[model samples]
Target: MITYRLLHPEILAGLAAAGHGAQVLIADALYPHSTGVPAPAARVHLNLRPGLVAARDVLEVVADTVHIEAAVYMADADGGESEPVREYRGLLGSHRHGGDQEVAWSGLERTDFYAACRRPDVCMLVATGETRPYANLLLRIGVP
Candidate 1:
């Protein structure tokens, strides 16, 4: 039996196969999982119910298991902004890593975020039932 917090089989498998610089997306409930991501990347749906599991909830688990070099959050193109994005940036900043391992946030447009998910480097996608707008996240794995 597994003792870790994240016991989901697909999430475990995806993390095990991922390496440094590989991208893993933790998408919000409303994000279009089917059409946004490519076919090759593993897609795990943890969104059982509305707000049952938030993006941050999944982020904490993924952060614990993987070496995260950088993180990207969706932003408003017209500068309308998002509270969740601000909170997420703060959360990532509070985490400290060893030499050459830094956690930083880069704001990407909604379209840009979608474009990035289509890249060949993306390894997996976790779709959570987070109803908050702009709650989507993209994590870049680092060397362990």
Candidate 2:
């Protein structure tokens, strides 16, 4: 029986196959899932409909499932931290339900973020139904 909130089989399996230093991308609906990450990366589509699922929701569950070493956000061109980025920081910074330590985090330009995702270290890509702009988050797994 499942003991945690993250019950999706594919997601669970993908995460299970990943190890420390592996990356996971939980992105908004607008993200280009098909071509964003490398070919070896496992893909899970939770985009049922507009706003059906939120990136933050996925992040919360993923954080609970894995020890996140770092979080990378897709930044705005103006180099400003968006609302979603602030919320992500608050969630990842505190010793909350999912995260036990303050995570090392940063922001990357859209292209830079996408390029980062294309790297082979990304083991999973979860495309959410979040409608908010700049709601994407990329996580690097750490030791439990």
Candidate 3:
């Protein structure tokens, strides 16, 4: 039996198919899941209802399931960190890959973030029900 928090078959298959440097986007309810990512990217919809699942919740499980090399957040309009970003940072901080190597962190404007997600390198896109604005996150998968 699978022993980790991430048990979704499609998610596991997608992650298994993705190699290092592949990106995964865990987006909020407000995100445009259908068109946000490229057509080749695998889609996993966890947005059961309004606030049924959260971007942070998906991030937590994904983080634990794979080795994350970097993290990118959608910056607030004012270029300041949003509340969801702060919460995500805390969660990412608790997970590590390749010993003490720190996960590279960065941010981009809303448009730029969407552009990044549309890139071919993104292997999977997860749509969550998080209601917080600017709660989108893009994670880079790393080697185990």
TM-score attained by model 1: 0.90
**What lDDT tens digits, residue by residue, belong to model 2 across residues 42-127?**
99999999997888888888887888888899997687778888888888775332336668889999999999999999999999
lDDT of 1 by residue, 1-144 (tens): 999888889999999999878899999999999877888999999999999788888888887787788888888656444777776776777564555556977878888889988898888999998898988888888875
lDDT assessment of candidate 3 = 0.92
Q: What lDDT tens digits, residue by residue, belong to model 3 across residues 60-133? A: 88888899999999999999789999998998997888878878899999999999999999989999999989
In terms of lDDT, the poorest run of 10 residues in model 2 is: 93-102
User: In model 2, which residue pairs have backbone atoms overlapping below 3 Å?
Assistant: none
Clashes of each: 0, 0, 0
**Candidate 3 TM-score, C-alpha based:** 0.96
Better of 2 and 3 by TM-score: 3
Instruction: Give the winner by lDDT.
Output: 3
